[model samples]
Target: MITDPARLLVYESDGLTAYRTAPRAVVLPATTEEVVAVMKLLHAEGIPVVPRGAGTGLSGGALASPGAVILGTSRMNRILSLDPENRLARLQPGVVNTRLSDAARPHGLYYAPDPSSQTTCTIGGNVAENSGGPHCLKYGVTSRYVVGLTVVLADGEVVVLGGAGADPY
Candidate 1:
């Protein structure tokens, strides 16, 4: 991996024209195990984790703190499964918001919550921000479309938010 100060700065500063403090390092994990391992390392070292995708965040959520490790999920942008029958998709967090609709288009289905940055924003970021869009008034925000999530907690344990049962909210 090409890990350098300038590279990390570019990745962190993509969304904002003016930003501060690049990252100490950047990692692109391809699998759940890899991501969890990185998280565990950060936790052990007391280094902060900044989860990012597409760098489209208008706010500074993706911005890196000093010496923090920037975890860009862009490389993990893959649709694991799309079940039109179930009206859901098991997706990696880095998948673009609009990409879901594109993937769903073949089945005449679409993921709701088409944010203004749908083409650029990532699902994980949307989940974190509870991001809303123009159609949200009628449809709902990304929170509504999400039936479940595989979350990594602060302790570095992987947990599923929802199971085979219904939404279970």
Candidate 2:
């Protein structure tokens, strides 16, 4: 937990830079288990939780509330699994968008929807905001490449939405 105002200032806004709000605290959880634990503790105390992914969102979606806690996904970045045959990759939300393409390039694959900020934007933020870039006009957006998600609901329940082999259609 980061209570230092100097550090909390970093979580005040995102790439947009138009809107800003200082959060009460900043919590960087490195794992899903840690995220869940923080959420449970915050839920019991009635503290609001704001999920942030790299702070690269151009839409100010990552802006923290007046007294909410910012849960950054930077430390959670890890490529959990990769299935080249199935063209699937299970990654933590903190994984940079370009990192995925870089890793999959060795397998002769690449993630579509190349946002201009892919190098710095997190996949989780892209998925959450349905972000896209120049390639979107031809290859669609992040939603198309996203096969699954593991989300923590408002009630602090951890749920896996889809799987590597799960059919979206």
Highest-scoring model, lDDT? 2
For 1-169, candidate 2 gives per-residue lDDT tens digits of 8999997888899998878999999999998889889999999999998899988888878888778999899999999998899899989999998899999999999988778888988988898889889989898988888767889876679998777767866
Give candidate 2 regions above 4 Å deviation. none
Tens digits of per-residue lDDT, candidate 1, 16-128, equal: 65876678888888888888898998899898988877777677888888778888888888999888887768899899988889999999998787777888888988887
Clashing pairs in 2: none
Candidate 1 residue pairs that clash: none
Identify the runs in model 1 with alpha carbons over 4 angstroms from their true place: none
Each model's lDDT comes to: 0.80, 0.88
